[model samples]
Target: MTRSHALFILMLSTALPQMALAQAPEAQSGDADILVTGRAEKLYRATDTEIGRGSSDPLDIPQSVQVITSELIRDQGARDITDLYRNVAGISASQYATVTYRGFRQDGNFYDGMRGDPFQGFAVPSLFSIERVEFLKGPVGMLYGASAPGGMINYVTKKPQDEFAASLRGIVGNYDRYGGSGEITGPIDKDGVLTGRAGAFYEHVGTVQRNSDTSSLVLDGGLGVKIGPDTKMTVQLTRYEQDLAGRLRGIPIDEDGNFLADRTWNHLEPSDYMKLNGTVAQMRLDHKASDALSFNLSSRWFRYKEDQDYHEPRPVSDTDGDGVPDTVTREFRRQHRNIEGVTIAANMIAHVQTGPLRHTIAAGGDWYWQQSLFDGVSTRAGVPPLSLTNPVYGLVPVGGYDLSNGSVERSDTRSHRYGLYAQDQIDWGRFTLVGGVRQDWFDDADPVTNTAKTSGKRTSWRTGGIYKPMQRVSLYASYSQSFEPQDPSRQSASVGGPFAPVASRQVEIGAKGELLGGKLQPTIALYRIVRRGIVQVDPDLAPINGVDQMSPIGEVTSKGIELTLAADITRDWVLTANYAYNDARITDSAPGAAIDNSVGGRFPNAPDHQAGFWTRYQIPAIDAAFAFGGQYVSGQLARSGAHMKGFTVFDGSVTKGLGFADLMIRIENIFDKTYATSAFDARRGAFVGRARTVFAELRVNL
Candidate 1:
């Protein structure tokens, strides 16, 4: 271990006893529930959250954190994270397999409070086993080291219950879609010291595109044991597999942002396919050592593998001496990857008193190890160009191509990360102060080359305050910093060595409150985030071996305002609404930076304005509920200055409770709106959003 690391550990050991002794003698029990449980009629208010690590109330966090409750997920029939976009402000799904939040791309996915896998190049997790989703926005490095500046999304899984319960559900939808899922939970011991839960789901679905279908399966199980009066341990396991036949590449668009072909067009061969398989196992222990202190330890192991063989269409070119492009070519490619990782974390929460102020202090240390192998090959020959006006299918020969002998590239990489952090929330009368600091060390190596390519260390900090002027209102402001290491593979050879980590900082002010006799809740926030040290091609250095040299560029900034509202308007009615306006651009760049010419350009895929609203009503006499919602996104710029038109889509659902089951019918894109959900480049192509679709589901509980 390095000297710096040893010193850090020594300091942490010395502070532990001081923190415990500082606790108040009259402190309350430390058994406060850590999970957000129990369903609410309205979607607005959440009393507790795990985002703060210590389950602090949202109003006291001084940052923007949105919770998509299980109730809301069911009402919207959400199948994946993307389906929840209508409920979250300032977030958009991008074409490059990542989500754009506040103009920054985020590819991190977390399960519970620990890091999971990279979101890109993988299928979205099933919602059947997820209890809820939490989105924490802004620079959160102090709590979660080495993360995107925009934010992170966390999935909280369901736990075993002491009482017996079981549920079964079946679903059928348009486009030849069908699925079934079941879950059961109960006690395994008469004394209730042991409990178990299990869930499984299978789905076969067809897409609007021709010859494209998907099959998926997921299995989850967990066991919980109460070892002592104040201690509990749980073990969980999950397995998931998915296969997609004839996956579709996006359709190309014209200079005017008009689709060159039909929205449902499939550019890939019918034989192309993609598959994903993964397994995860986790163990957790929670113990309340004393009335003023608690400890939690969790460890997880994950293995994931994926394979894909597909074809993509190239841009149209004018071959007939005409201004308009009339021909396009297709290229075939294949790729395979395997990833494995392990993570462990230990944390302690202490309720202490300093003078006349009360404090909740949390300290934690985490470690992660990951290894990955990737192989790829692509055909050198391209398919003949086809006519733009009249396309021919099955014209290209596929039997003669040899994939094994094609151009091949393979690599193996391993990485390790360690982090230690501490945070304290201090309360004095009507004012609350929050402060935190974290240090992280990271290393990456390539086994094929037998070299350690990169290593680094960094520290992050955050400070904020909250003031409650009334019983129902909180006003707060905060500033935080984050850092993320740049992959050496992406850096130019001219850099000579590993590039410096990208740094980001944010300043935010927000207000949250309850109104109308606790029936209504609202939140508003204004924030600015700035990112520096982004890698860019060095204009002065010409390409060597077809690769350009790179250097650190200036800064990019995203500033925005957001508003959210949730209300239980009446005994039978609930409503949720949100709106956001974001302005993101490159503020500065080096003279020789590749993006220097486009420093003033807006960030791609980031819309300037977005708004959405959903409302549901229940009829007690008939035991039925109906919901309707609509979302709007303003025009956005593509990567090459092309403009994408704004669009609005509507959705509706109806549910009726039967004696032993509940029936639900849902329709999305009620008006069959045609729009581009994401784009590659201006001339390359853009993904078409889903057309009007319908689904019917039946759920039974025992």
Candidate 2:
């Protein structure tokens, strides 16, 4: 055998145990047909959720829910939640931290079932203290107030445990990448009345793109107190800082809409950078007055500050009439922003028998407030021309920016929202019905003057029914309506008033079952979503008054089928797979819409076909685990009609169990494929996918 093959086999023969100590798989009963529901009972399979039904039985719920458990996160070596989206059916990745669900691109991220955005502009979330990520599809406005109509993604954080445990992990990879993380959780008192946990993660990594590197530091700590036999309280705090010395705006496409010749070529110099610093504090109280009644109250406060200094490629010209363009103009800009928000939610659940049915009723109220301040943007400076064929750097001095040129722009806005909602789940033998209604009132105001700029109100509802044909199988159908407030700034007095809120409706039918004693969990859903009142730019108004006016006449629809499965084929085998077929199209638009934006045209970044699979198996003979996975996304068009290519990437990893430490080697993009991930029109170019990358990690648990 070759030396490399011999070494690989040797590495796989030595074993100890899995190193993820935060969560341990539950011991199953000897009965192979027994049904089970627990967080880690079957590795990747989830039994309950905190998002839709508040830890209710999955089979009885009529909503589509997906989860990424801790075991899956560790085995896949996912550093951020973004890396886990593919495992969830029907979720399409858009640029930045945005994602498309049900045909609508949205920024509807949450924290612990509340309104909190861990990732800000140009920044990503750190999974240092996260336990599991939950995806709740369809409209949640009935519970979450104003949000994207497509769905919502919530990040559940780890809490202090009564059991004592600690772990330390380190990672090293190509491109001079290395990082480490440490975590500890245990009881602080001998009586076990109080518990505490702490974790920290730090990484400095570079990418294949020139001068594209990022450094990040994240710290999390939490405390839990058992106040009484029926009441408990928990608090969590997190601080994060991430910096990029060089911004990766994306590769600039050529005149013919072709991607840059060298994907690694970066037009922005290393001197340009962005920094994001954020802090969050949250507390929750759980109280049970009786077996049929309970209360959950939560509050969170967050502040995020961002600073950016970057250059953008602007107005391009061919100089000559030829279709092949050559020269490019760049614009240099700087900005500083501050975002602060607060959210509070109080919910009460009660179970009671009425007539021949048992009812699980939930009532809640939420109060949310947020304000943003932006300033310190210098005047846009002109830089030397660039070539579409070849590029030159260092022509514009970093200090050449003139802040006194009066081109700076600033805005300070604030919003206050209040909501009240009530839901009822009626159980009648093998049938379950759920109905909910919510009313939300929001006021957009000036942060400094506290003057109301605009106000609006919305009422939303969702209803569904689940029928269990078999003991472990359920068929369900649901319909929901959602609304999102429009930006107050978009309201021009000349246009009468603020545009109507973007509204959405969806009809979904699905099936859920746990086969093989709950070792195999599957959910399949077919849904159609319609969104209206989307605002778009009007070129006629912009030229008429020198100010762009937006018209809210855009509409779109999405129809798709999604299938997700997680299975424990054997004692040591785990698998997760997903597939989706979405047909998203524009149904209506304004007169000024682009050629590609006509009716029946495909939606931007909404791929027609997407599939992903991941699996891991432990060979008792070798005492090690091997995993392989791949992702495929069909080609899609940008909002500006630029067609971005699609791609399929494969990844593999080998995990070894040592006496004191677990070791892992992972290779991403095994074929060294080069492809574009997304595009925001041809001028801004496309974001390139990660090239072949190799990383190794050693995790020690104590």
Candidate 3:
């Protein structure tokens, strides 16, 4: 570790006491019934979740779910959802929003339980107005419909508060990083029947990568109105805007895994640019029919547009047999895309008792529609090659080539999914049985002609039993199934159209404990997931720009175990830790596939071993706090037998509470470690990790 960074952390150790959650007023429990469980007063310790639809005790839910609370976010100085993933087991990330959960890839994160892309076209979601982030691991198709086998990330955003509140925060750091945010929430009516909240944040940043600079802006607000005493309505709107230039894809590597160039280097032209604009609107209505029943209706509208032009690296070759890669092949690529979607969901929840069983039943239906138009093109033959040691710039044209002719492609498609789901939790004293089922119909069509291209259906289900040997403790086992519709464009003449959707299933067993009067919560889980219905390129069909039609023909199996803990040792001490061991490999595949997803090969980015730890201590008398944490990942395969070496990065911070504002200093990558967030073959290098970053922030609450 760097001496200067170490000294800063040393100063923090002596400057703080008690974390913000232990003393802050706004850090109260978000769910109304969660506080009734016990005396666990630690904000870092999670006791309940709403991932399965409604507020529920985590121990009662059979699946492994993880929560990152607002208090934890503040204490860790987390700037986005990705920052909190270190505390979650079995998660790996690539550049941008591509994430690997367990052994599978999730297209994007969800917002308030709805399936959608938060990183739609580079509008990377940030953490300005989020209340908490929940990660539900393993096959959620029974509830969410047609999703990745690994899991889903649900972002619970901030809503109107019950009382008047306001806060402001600002930060400044290296790489010209500077940003500020302000938020306000209060009752808008004298009778306390109407409430409203609003917030805005903006940031401009430069990275260690040369010529890479970017900025983002977020504006959000919401209103809540109580209709009589039995009903409530909430309406929210959020906007996102981002502008970027010279974004680095990754650093190319050789057989020896030696760096070809400095981390700051990239092959993209200095003038290359990318931009994203998005807006989201959401509404929810809740009504209580009687003491034993309630109803909920929620809907969302999402729209985004992104534009990009850059130099993408292709496979590196050792044709000369020198062990070192000859050069980074560069190609000019361009894309312009627009996305629009809407989703509506309605559900009913009931609490009832039968002769020998008490039941919590929930039934719901959802309708989702999305339309997209993307124009893309890439140059292959004429693109220049980037030197490993020295590089020249600006040889490729950036201002030309719309997706119009032979090698160019324009995708204009629309899709809709309809789902019906029902779930029941049966409770008889200390034993609980939960069962759920969902049926989904999916259709894809051309947006312009409105002609159907493909249609499919899937039925998914989950069943589990939980046994509580003692109060606040649970042991559980479950089996669940999931499915994802295959895209129409992937169909080939050989395999034909109307292919079945990809199917996934899992078996899991776990135990949970809420101890120390809610001060500590721990979980241990083991599971195996199997996935079938893969897509392989059809040599029967010709290729365009090296891309060909595909047919389904593969299977994969992933087994893993996870151990996690969140503890509030005392009023002044809090910590969270996690470790995961995963074995993910292909069990079947076509003889010749386009890429390296072959039989017996491990999934890319799914590290065999990964772990993280974070702890914080507070000195209440002086209103000071100290936190230290680090993340470690083991070497793992990427693709084509290419592997990424692993490294550990440490982060530490200290905070001092003033009457109106808290001051904090945070250091990321204290050791200045150089690693990759994602890796690829010799042609494509690895995404370089950021170097050491030091920043200071001031927060004010009133």
Q: Candidate 3 residues 230-285, lDDT tens each?
A: 99999999887788884467777654455678888877778888888788899999
Clashing pairs in 1: none
Give model 1's clash tally.
0
Report backbone clashes per prediction. 0, 0, 13
Q: Is candidate 2 or candidate 3 better by lDDT?
A: 3
Better of 1 and 3 by TM-score: 1
Candidate 1 residue lDDT tens string, 106-171: 676888888766334657667777888888889989998989898888888888977666666789
Candidate 2 per-residue lDDT over residues 210-263, each given as its tens digit: 768888887788999999999999999998888886446667664333675477
Return the TM-score for each candidate structure.
0.90, 0.90, 0.89
TM-score of 2: 0.90
> TM-score: which is higher, 2 or 3?
2
lDDT of 1: 0.79
